[model samples]
Target: MSTENGTIGSQGEVNGDVMLTHFRKKDDDDANGEVETEETQVYIENYKDKLLIYGINDSPPIHVTIICALQQGLLSLSGQLIVSLLVAEAVCASKNDAFKARLLSSTLFMSGITTFCMNIFGIRLPLFQGAASEYVIPLLLMADTDQTFCTSEPSKEGGQSPVPATTTMSPNFTNSSLGNYTNNDEITMDRIIYNVQMIQGSLVLAGFVHALLGFTGLIGVMLRFVGPLTIVPTLTLIFIFIVGPVIKFVEVNWGIAFSTIAVAVILFLYLAKYNMPVPVWTPSLGFRIIRYPLHQVFAILISIVLNWLLCGVLTYAGLLTDDKKNIGYNARTDARIQIVRDNPWLTFPYPGQFGPFGFSGAAFISCMIATLISVLDSIGDYYACARVCRVPAPPKHAVNRGIMIEGLCSMLSGAVGCGHATSTYGGNIGAIGVTKVASRHVFIATGVIYILFGIFGKFSALFISIPYPVLGGAIVVMFGIFFGVVISNLEVTNMSSPRNIAIFGLSIFIGLAVPTWAKKHKSPVQTGHAMFDKIMSMLVGNPNLVGTIIACFLDNTVPGTAEERGIAAWQVSEEDERADVDRTEFNEGYEVYDPLIPRSIMYSKLMKYIPFLPYKRGNVEKELGNVKTS
Candidate 1:
């Protein structure tokens, strides 16, 4: 291990036992990539009060920061685009172009602001925040409950149809202005507006619940029971559940899908080991040549660009068809050009941009379930992200604050009529691992990029046509790596033990199987009460939640010691070489109070005893006693 003075030994960081390995290296050299400790010391010292990373404060050049930010920002945009489109189709019934445009603008705006909050004050990591999939099922259930809101007929001008059970609605429904709709069409718009209002109200309420969970410190206590076994399957299912969507896109154009996938693999895997020398000027050091992994850094974006170029060439050659049904149709270029021509150059999204808000019991209950799932999934993301950044697991307080920030974002989404919620994107989190660029400043730049994209409506619209197969191919690579990351957490666990194997095996099998079956069957889970049944069906229907719950429950209930379950080794301690030995250090780098804010509740003894306050200071035994009771 490297000494605290920042000197390295010849042995280097290594371990033999796979079942007892820490996820990240303890040495500073490996932890901070090529950047030295003194280079990042100023930023870390400035934010000494919070849990900041070398990546966040490591002052990369302005151009490097912008490039990294844009790269990570694109990954986040892909998820937001998918969710915004789904909301336009599922909730607006492919009829209200105004609502669709408003939803897209609002989410883009909300995501930018929320992500800024998360990086600065919440998780204090390089995690990219984006639209979450947890709300999709609940929103779909809400739409199904009121068919009038989503009912549609084939358009006279275009081949517009109702959102199919097998496919998302085509964008052709959002080609005109709301004023174009006839008197009868206005009535349909009214119903759709009402439905949108109900969803907004429910999400607002759910956000409050999320805040309560964080404030009461209940989330901290819950974290005690979450082990690597539970996390492995939970994180794995996130990617596994995307199989349906990936298959749908791949089936559309196998050639494009294969090409995109091939490029991503070649860049990410094949070229990953090679680094190119870049010249840089430093005041003290004079000049230096840094071997940067340029190819791997731009792998995902490069793969997409290569595919896009091929598609454009085919389009020019007249080999690409205009028919939507044809496999050779260049949807990427066509959609981009069309949206740019249709939308305004600039548009600003504000509160209540769509219509008035309303509430429904069924929608509210379903949203609560969605909130829980989002929280659970985010916990796994926190761990995985920390691992990639070469940091220890976040402490109770940081996790609580992270969720609270997400709740705030959710409320903002509801207010803005986004019809969906925001959460940390696992795909982007995994990218931190793939690209090995975990700079906090880069992500801050990403937030700025998102905001700029949102403001320039035409600018955002241009990317709306990103080829489906290219995106699908990228999804496959990201999710595949995410699954590998989840399994890596199990390195500390005794995989050879039949008991551990059974726990992981059963949790994963059921998590994937239940959701697949539920989606195919489309049968409502009955619980006698209508509202209760709707909620149950929504919760049970989601694959990620089902798998996580099963794994968490079985892992805790089953008989085994902490070591046998890998809990002991998976966590970090003060003795670890990478850890700071300050008494205030409470699991990882997260402190109990913000040094910048003296009047913060963290300073109060009464608050410390409240359990979820994350207040770890003097009179520790008293605080523990109070925690057990409160």
Candidate 2:
């Protein structure tokens, strides 16, 4: 569908009808449902040709183009994973169907440019730009839980003896204090700083595998292997992974955090209550809700500044003495003075540091295990995107492109010395859903913001200034939206069980409230991850978790992906017998028209057929017929 334009139109569509089937729409803002005439359509198609004619471009956005960037700094492990997912989204989203020619070019140049600036200017790697590793869990479990850092020959119990006097390290590496770490126990900072450059090896390997899989179009098969249930847990993990940390943060700096949150709420209310001003921020870059007050963004801005100032003061006043002074903590960090002495400039994380540290029989095994989890996480992420995009599933190529980019970034991170594997986060997906602008270019714009930090270095304080509580507030609000979406995405086949629903919420409650309460009460474990791992270990240290068990039961094995498992479900369909309905959906070319299928899904599928350059409308009709005839 189109509207009147100068000579033609600008919107998403397939020019070559033979292979490409495009279903156009008038953007939601265009309330008028005027259809474009054939003549106008032809002109519009030619215009698209001209855009492609200019030669595709995807370099990092100019440094001065963007104004601000949101940095998820020092989150809980799960939160870190979610944050990494978000970071990956900002990066990978830049690579649309053009095979990321633009994204690759942009990323390569941006990375190099940033690396050079930090090297030359003696500049800090703007604390603003951080790549998170969702796979750090496995890597951390291996490296952090390893015997290398321990003192007394590593016993089974948690605490260990002081170093043997022969070695330089202590018994409990997690407890940096044991070895006289100067930065107290800033494990999050220490872990990422020391490990950033090393994770690149895992990233490169992951990228290679993902790219290979993409070329072979394995994403589809892999997707079928993962099911809604697996997604449920993974997403739940993601939610907890994301939101749990926020709650803990809220608990820690209650005055600063809660105050920041209160203002954010009031700001949201004001914005929501007022008549929004035009172009407060672009609809693409920010959500310009008609119902919300445009000025609340400023409230958020003010809150960020005030909280930072307060935190800076608090740290000075001994309120944050634990982390600032870093006395009897862990995470292998030394004092501020020592950090300055070891390396004046914080180094970017390298690629190979993440996968079991060194290449060994055991290291290899650990990396492989980590890789599997990465793949699993990636699969879930892809589906969440697919659901959001409204495609039944992603085209294999798209999946590969996305995954390869994710792995590639991880590989690069390994080289950079960070503990991150940036994957697409459902939380960001939630953001997109809330904003309702899924243009890949906008995320590309976001990555530009990430790259800009190294170029200009202005936004670090903006990020630094954001109070943990305010960040927590934004997270809780958005994730609440996402949790709703996931539940909506699922079938209620088992919803009747208060027990099952409780089981689902059990994870959420345990994951969120327990950690926050534990932290507020001053538990021995500093971060939520430590508490979670310890709790899970106590409850059941099963190599295969409850989620794994359910996925196996419903799907019967790691059939390798969500799609393969889908086919299995398809084969086992008792829908006809159960509901006594006709099933014409299997035969190829049968078209089923369901008005309920979101337009986004239809459009996404159509994009896949574009490269082939032509399509048979009858085939789509036939495809729809199968479902309709049913």
Candidate 3:
């Protein structure tokens, strides 16, 4: 044991492994220098082992930044497009090619705006914000409850509704035909518009509550009970529940889908280590050969491009038939080619662009629940991003600020009628790990690229034209990675403990089983009030939210040590554990997340009162002393 000032640090053996314990001297005169045993466990992983080519603060050359930005932009665009397409199908707007194209553009626009604002004023991490897949669950539930939309679902028997046959196949398809909406088309458009409005209003309300949670520091208090067991089941169930839809998409063209999957797997796994030489010209060095991890960095983008090209070739060669009734007709690249010509050359997404906002009690409740889940996911992503970037976990204030920014951004997404909330893209975080470039500049540049593409309507429409099977294949790999990342949370937990195993297994199994049951037996939650019935049904039907609730309840109530529950590592309090950590190291980590303001202003005493600012010299000293005496 060693004592410095009033702080005490000691090491002891527990189950043959060393455990660190901290204590502080008591101020009471009941005994002679009696000390209180706080027993605050510290689990500091060696983040320095994983070095980066361009760190969080480093700014690469302009050319290099643009190249990296483009790669990240493509990944972000693909993710946003997938979620938008899913939302379109859920709201029965898949047949409205024009509206679907606009929705995709709106999603991209909001993602870009949020990504830019976040890196500049929020977490200051290299996290790319995009449409969250978790919101799809609630939308699916809403669609099921809607009588008009769910009355005769053709997509259920077949796959997603293909582009209308009336849409011209010409490269310059006129907008005159697009504007000729029949009575039936008008009704469908009204329903789609109404559904999007409901989503918008609900997201706006949820974002306000979400922002309040962060601003008031309530999220920090809630974090006390969140652990790996709670997080693992909650996040893993998200991908697990979406398997049916992914399968439906892949079934559109099994051959094309599997080929896309094979290409992704080969590039991401088998050829990850192979480096390709690129010739570059610079004023300092006229020409030079730079070995780049091309396969690793551009794996997903390359796979999509290659498969898309193959699909086009097959379509042109008459191998892929264009019959509307054909099984694999939607696999052809030209299936939705009219979308590109129908969309304007330039466009802007503004609030209430999709008619006035509307609210539904059931939708609001479901969105609120999804907002909470998104918060938890973002917190976990922050930690993972930090670890991957070779930095200490973010401090409390930085995390609170991040959540607040996400809430505000979600509101923007809703206002713009994106029909989905924005959240940190886990795939991009993994990309950071692979590419060894976590520069905020790269992310900011990527955000600019997103904004640019979003403004150019034709570009967004071009991407929206990707074949369903190709996207399905990519979604499979993406969601699979997501599931794997969620499960990786178990690394810090004592998995051997039956207590932990039982909690996770029961939570996931019941979570999945109950949702399946609810789907089969519709109207399982028929309360006296119609609104209440809708709310209950939607809540009960969401596998992620259900699993999260179960995991949190069991994890908190069940008796288990901190180590077994994984809370020891998950709940790292910067304020409470400051005495045990090196002062310089702690400050350095905090600085990484500090705002772009001058240090003097950011660390000012006034900033201490703000819940989201990193004020280093405020009540920290007093809190530490109080903690010692208490």
Candidate 4:
């Protein structure tokens, strides 16, 4: 592997056994499109740190963007646009036409950038771009289908439309924003065409960076500073940031929220009691007694179904509001999609679309921070792939090459009005681990799908229409799951220290609660913390203004003295340590850290807290050892 140190090995691995272990599927004769199994993901690292990365192993990292996507959709707007563009470029830049690594790498990179941007800039760019994992196989199917169908289809003028159909090249599709399953709408074809140009623009940047890195050979230098432990925490923090906003949402929309949660619970149980369909055929569970795919798709899907029925019931009971304005903005948006299908392309950004573009300065200024986050994302994604492949693709230079590809792609995506930089995501890694299919060729197929989706924007519209509450429910589960995962990952060198435990709890509490209070009061900053303008006579100190300024520079920007950040990071670390210990104790074991499984160790916490949950009347001093005895 190429690194700051040097080339350590070929960085290429080809073991029939490891492949068989992680990548195989029973139904697929052609294993290239097969799904990755949890077993394979479980085997990624073979050392102590492995335990740390998996965070109790059995669950998903729900915190990061999944929580953010549903609540604010901040990242969904720009972040999604950025990653999609970069991914398309990365896939296009792959040599030997091997695009899978480029796409998968983007997933982790997206997560990484999300972490880095928040820490480095006084910016928290929304990081909700999930990996385009689910779409890969479908694109592959389309690519490999008969030329008569996949390449060119019959026209819509009755039978074949009588218009001669011609085959066209598919746009590279791994562009993520192109294929999302939005909130509450059906997929349409118009979106597919518009995306092709956007996807093209995003990749244009990737090609430049790839060209620069490939020819200059600077890929080796970037790998030295990054590692798993640091990255894991940042990603973990993402969930923290996301969950805070989501919890507030549940509190605000209790009626819809409760119904949504109930639907997810029922679906999880149903899937557990019976066999269900999964790509390449699969069935498994570790916690929530719920199958993963079912939770991912049907948790929200079934919730919507039940909610619609409930909508009717509420109407019958005279408790439902008849005001269309209060129902939600989704219905009109959905109808708009159908109306705009034929003329959707007319909305694309134009150079002079608004005035002469002379002083469009604020537009770029406000978005400048967002653009940089995309770079961090690109860098993170490259490292994730470099680490996993374990061997340097070019004898220790692949990371640089890979990043360059994404960087240039970012510029292109930005020019096209996407503004968000392209990066990788972790969600896609789950897909890779489950499917075991690592072929770049299939990724290219996926890229083509994105292009089509971009062209047919209605597809995105359908997902966008899904109600916020249904999304809120999914975010709740994911946030809880991510909390479990992060807590599982929260290990420290000195866990016994009291100071550490206090710090851990306080940091988590503050981070979550501060955001909570702000969201509720709609007052992100207090008047005392606001900036004051000192006129010629006197000064006006607005706490909210000062707080806003401080909030902007506080955690991210290099504000104040070194003493400030060190103290803060350490104090937070202490709190994190306790949370980690508690998380570990709760999960029970290495088997996916399934807390759902009955285990004795988990009871120790409640018993420790209340000193009463356990049936056995064990002495408190003995149960908690140092806590009570000391």
Predicted model with the maximum TM-score: 3
- Residue clash pairs of candidate 1: 55-440, 56-440, 217-612
Return whichever of 1 and 4 wins on TM-score: 1
Cα lDDT tens digits, model 3, 148-211, are: 5533322323242422323411223223323433234444444455567667888898888888
Q: Write the per-residue lDDT of candidate 4 for residues 1-630, one digit (tens) a residue.
A: 234422222212322212112332233345684643222322212211111112212222243223312222221322243334343432222121112222322332332333333212211111123332212212222222212221122335434222111112123222232333221222122222222233334334433554364335443332233222223333443544445445544553467767877765665444433323323223542322211233432344456556645644554565644455664332222322442343233122321111111111222221332233233334444333322222121122223334443454444443332323445444332222212222222232333334433444444444434444544554564344334433432332133544334444444444345444533432333445322111100101111112222332333333333233222221212123223233323322112111232445543545333211112234545645744465
Which parts of model 3 have CA positions greater than 4 angstroms off? 1-51, 89-92, 146-188, 575-588, 618-630
**TM-score against truth, every candidate:** 0.78, 0.51, 0.80, 0.39
State the lDDT of candidate 1 residue by residue for 42-104, as single tens digits.
Answer: 100111112222343455667867877877776666678778877766666465555566577
lDDT of each: 0.67, 0.38, 0.74, 0.33
- Which stretches of candidate 1 lie above 4 Å from their native place? 1-54, 145-187, 277-290, 515-535, 569-630
Candidate 2 on 1-630: residue-level lDDT in tens? 345442333343433311113344333344574644333222122221121111111122232112112322111112432344333322222112121121222232234333222212211111111233444344434443343422213333554222222232122222232232222222222233223223334455654664455445465565545555555654565554544446664654556666665665565444433434433343333543222222432344455556556665665665564654332111111122231232212122222222233222322334444455556655555555444433233334344545444555555544433334444445555443433233333344445444543233223222323445545555564556557667654452244545345444544444444434433432324345764544433222212233444443444432233332233331222122123223232111111111123433543447444321112233555556665798
What TM-score, to 2 decimals, does candidate 2 have?
0.51
**Candidate 1 or 3, higher TM-score?**
3
| Alpha-carbon RMSD of each model | 10.1, 14.5, 12.5, 21.1
TM-score of 4: 0.39
Q: Which ten residues in a row have the lowest lDDT in candidate 4?
A: 532-541
Better of 1 and 2 by lDDT: 1
